[model samples]
Target chain A: MPFAPALHSEWLKIRTLPSLAAGPAAVVLVTAAFTALAGLDESAGADSDPLFASLFGVVLGQIAAVTFGAQAVSAEFRGGALRLSLSAVPHRGRWFAAKALAVGASALAAGLLAGCASLAVGWAVPGSRAGGPNWGEGLRGVVGCGVYMALMALFAAGLTALLRSGVMTLSILVPFLLVVSFVIGGVSGTAADYLPDKAGQVVLHSTSDGALGPWTGLAVTAVWAAAALAAGAWSVRRRDA
Target chain B: MTSIDVRDLTKEYGGRRAVDRLTFSVRPGRVTGFLGPNGAGKSTTMRLVLGLDRPTSGTATIGGRPCAALDEPLREVGALLDTGAAHGSRTARDHLRVLAATHRIPGRRVDEVLEEAGLAAVSRNRVRTYSLGMRQRLGIAAALLGDPRVVLLDEPSNGLDPEGIVWIRELLRRLAREGRTVLVSSHLMNETASFADHLVVLGRGRLLADTPVREFVHARAEPRVRVRTPDGAALRDLLARHGYESVAEEGEGAGDRWTVRHARVDDIGRLASGAGVTVLELAAEERTLEQAYLDLTAAEAEFTAMSPSRAQEA
Candidate 1:
């Protein structure tokens, strides 16, 4: 089947459900809400990156990105949904591609919106702030934040498809992002630099210490997303609906 | 018209076979009833045909081509396998709209099917609010959305009311009249008997019978003759002398009725007359489709229950 109609169908599925729609909406709201709140904090370390302070809420916003991704795929595993979807398309690969595309698009939009809004809130705050990054660096952080969210969402979508369970995906992902990745990040080890969540969040920081720069960090996260998607596609093609 | 051909189709999960080299063909212009006791692999066969599950060793194809190869598959074969397939959060229209988009179907057809399935009034309502009967109707609507040449329904009457059942019975007959291939699966033999012109029955993942509905029912029914005579004792003696077994039926008229199995009505009548006994009634008891289905699948039944009559008596 041509991509146009399949894409349209996938888009409709995304727009139709309130819970699914909440995924992207939450990404923007959470990021902006947290970033705005952080700007009001009176204490600021002299060496802290100003852009990082503005976008501090992105860490939590990504929870929405991953949730949206997992839910998009997980909904198919419920209510005999896989049967209905496959019956309509028959070719599992094609159907999954459409689903992945839809998830990626939504996450990208949500990320961009969240990234921009968080920056605006941070830039406008009146509290004691560190020296703000120059224009080029500031612009990169906002756009990179959006792209990061999209990639993270796709990453979640891919893993959910492989597992075929949203609960399972969230169970492994949510706590790991909130606890394990940060703990490893605090250690400032090279291994933490390459983690999917941390690597993607590098764009939110104006200056970084590791060999991996903002763009390079996002690239590592993208590689992870690509691998998950490849596995997810294989699973959809080989398994019975 | 679309015809489905299953060539030695087999499906096994882990080690046990769910469908064992099952071969059957569903031709166009007729309603084929897929009959089986629950877990006799009726749904499995349908799933295999739809390419929902990969066959272990064989192939099932629609219109002489594999289902996966068909372009816009819904246009060739429309299927309703699981009644509760829709997502609860979406409205009924959204579900149909998504399926319709797969085939590049027009929005007009979506509205048409909403009316067709009697879901027009609640088109905007979320699927979670719909009753099981309504959900079944929505499934039926989704199947018909493509206006395909072949239609497959698995237990379409599952949650339907009496009116919905009658409506579906009429609908399937009409679809067949239009020269489309229609296959409907049901555990209820009597339900399928009402409209299915052809019957393909499975027992323990094997083809038990693929024949006309009328013959499968009455022919399989034990072929017993109910004899009633004023001199029942004399009739019993004659039956014993002829080496034919008789079971005395107890009821309102005890000792006046005896059922003779494996004997034609004419032979029983001849024996009664030769003995100079006046026969009051010599009616041959015809078997219903329900009974035929039970007798055919009794051995294969994984969990047997009391017969309908026995249950009623209890």
Candidate 2:
């Protein structure tokens, strides 16, 4: 079959499941709400990057993005779902690619919506708008957020496929994003900035002192996602359903 | 109509051979029973045919094409490996829709199958809320969604009530009547006997017997004659003289009753009549498919526990 039908099948699976369907909405709500709250906070330093603060909600929202990706693949492990899937579409590589594409598209759409909501909230809040980012920076942050969320979701998806368990993927990724990324960022080095989560988030910042620019940072994260996806596809092709 | 051809297919898991060099062909327009005892590699073989697992050796193909090579395989082959393959949170309709989408099968066909499986009223319910039988129906519905020419079902009658079993039996027959190749696996020979016209018996990952269902029973089970006669002793003596041994029946009417094995009813009647013995009742007892399957797989069962008394002795 052509890739479109496989992709359509994958899209149906995502939209039909309650937990999977809730992912995008959760991403938009959590990211927007947190970004609005952060915009309203009065304890900011004078030289704080307004764009990062406006899009700060992405840190929390990324959990939903990762979860969306993880569950898309992990659901297949439950009750021999993968067996059914493979029987329908026997080409494992094509199926995996379609699955990844569905996940990426959903997460990216949610990320863009979340980014716009966060920016709108920042403009609405008088305290945040006092030093808000210009339209060029805001536009970059919105587009960057979409690409960043898509890459993170793909990363989680690939990891889930490799691990063959959504819980295991979440256990590793959730902690890494919530704790390890920040802890490593605290250590002064350019290498820490290249970490998948940190590198992707650099695009949300209005100003940066790091060696990598916004697009390059996103590219670094994209490499991580690509590597994870490659590993996932290999696992799918090599392993029995 | 497509035929399933398996040639010396083998599959090994963790150094243990789940399916040995097994070969069988299922032709169109017939319901072939894939029979075996538990762990006799029936499921493994089906998985190999569907390309869910890589074979250690040999090949299985539908219409001369490997399952992986067929584009939109659902349109060519429909398989029901596990009833619970669908996500519990999704409704039966949605589960079928997901599979149907793969081959671009129309949404109307999904509803048609749901109705055909007698699950239309409950199609909107989440699979988690369904009974085992309902899930089974949903699985069958998904299998029929593409209206494929080849249907492979593993233990399809499991979790079904009597009426449901009968319903599935009729459905399999109808599928076969439509010139589709149907392979339904089961450990229960009696259940298989009710529907399958052909039998592919498996024992210890090896092909045991592949023939017509009736022929399998007739070939494996010893034919016996149940005779009740007033002069049973005289008849028994006459049969013994002809090198036929007869055992006395031990039930309520123990008087003048004999069961003769490996002897035709006509021969028994002729022997009795030649000796002027009066025969009260004489008939050939048909061996049930259950007995034939048990006799065939008696030594081939994967796990056979010793009797309680034998265990104590051991």
Candidate 3:
């Protein structure tokens, strides 16, 4: 009845559902594989930020994070599962909080693991023109990778709640990340940097060109996630299951 | 024991009232059947009671508090809204465990319900692999996970085989015997008549009848008397003199048999005896629950089919 048991219940749901459970593991695999491949590229110039290059796989790996968050909430909408869930918990706010916490914690754990794996493989790549990142840069990238992925996952989760459909959430987000974000970066100036993904990915860079520094960029993304979650919670409370 | 009390509960979807201003109470120690024609607001009422959907006005409470206000709902009430309530990817055991964890129910209790619902043999299988009947059993298993005092089910017999139907009937009876408040919704009149002691009939989002099963059948369905006589003309003449009319029933001996409404079997028998008319068969034909339900819900149905003759003409 208290928040702890509800959180435990949500965690159990994630563990049992194969699609949701695959999220964290996929984040690690995708990010590490891409980061290693990027490190092996000979076209990389000396001017390239090795830290960002090592963590480049995160750009693709974040899809898994988004999916993980989306699937966790979307599954409830399918097959009348939300009614069953609400019948058991009754308090919509508590259930949503528990769900968000479970998703955020699992994504954070996976992101941290992926960050370490990506950094290790990137630094060990042979014949790499890009030099190794300094100790401070390495720590920053690893921490940033974990926090950034978790925030992205939560962001997707909040949007999924508001939309109440994973397919719709993915349709809007996947293209925005794959196509729209880069297009904005090429044309739009400082305003484009404030986009949720763009702002959050700044932490993965060794140096940021945007108005926000690394922490400030992450903070901006956090605000986006918070606002999305607030909308999601409001939708859950106001709408019928 | 906790009872479900719904008071003036109204819910409207897109300006269409799904549940009108309705009120009813389900007492403990008995099974109350929630019956209705399609789109009759039975499921909507259940959803409102469980707080899955917000009501436009009024309240539905379990025990003395609204379901949302209960700190530990699972420990107080359990409901099976549909067979598809569980995710297909999770195993039956895991699904129950997830729900069980909400109230800190013991792991052993999950297995206990699985065994009770006759799903233990395949409890480890994913729900996607289950048959409709199996999914139904799994839903029942989830409802029993918390061992709550109040249980609600909506069309629980939808995909059940005869054996499963029998199993559910026994289960509902047992739950009632344990002094739990059990409310099950279904359009199957005979099935509900078999187990439920009280009935709450709904039509077009409005309450139609709320009474005992026997009373509903007796009060709503017109009773008829069948009379067989050797001298049909004499019996008919005697009945006509007494301000009674009879219709001949089609059968092996059409003219010899007659069915009379609004006339008691004993009255006809007395008249036949006094007039020297031999009565071969004289008995009151009680209507089946199905017939009674059809008669009551016929006008209230949303989609009534054209009569066979009218369809043929068209």
The best candidate by DockQ is 2
What's the candidate order when arranged by decreasing lDDT? 2, 3, 1
As for TM-score, the candidate ahead, 1 or 2, is 2
> Relative to the true interface, what fraction of contacts does candidate 1 keep?
0.73
- For residues A4-43, could you state the per-residue lDDT of candidate 3 as single tens digits? 9899999999999998889999999999998888778877
**How does model 2 score on DockQ?**
0.84
lDDT of 3 by residue, B154-273 (tens): 888988999999999999999999999999999888899999999998987888888989898888787788998777888888888998878877657534888987787788878889
Question: Against the true structure, what is each candidate's TM-score?
Answer: 0.93, 0.95, 0.94
Total clashing pairs in model 2: 0
The TM-score of candidate 1's chain A against the true chain A comes to 0.96
CAPRI tier for the interface of model 1: medium
Q: What's the C-alpha lDDT at position B169 in model 3? A: 99
For every prediction, compared with the true complex, DockQ reads: 0.73, 0.84, 0.82
**Docking category for candidate 2?**
high
What's the best-to-worst order under DockQ? 2, 3, 1
> Compared with the true structure, what per-residue lDDT tens digits does model 2 show for residues B18-62?
888998899999999999878889999999999988999999999
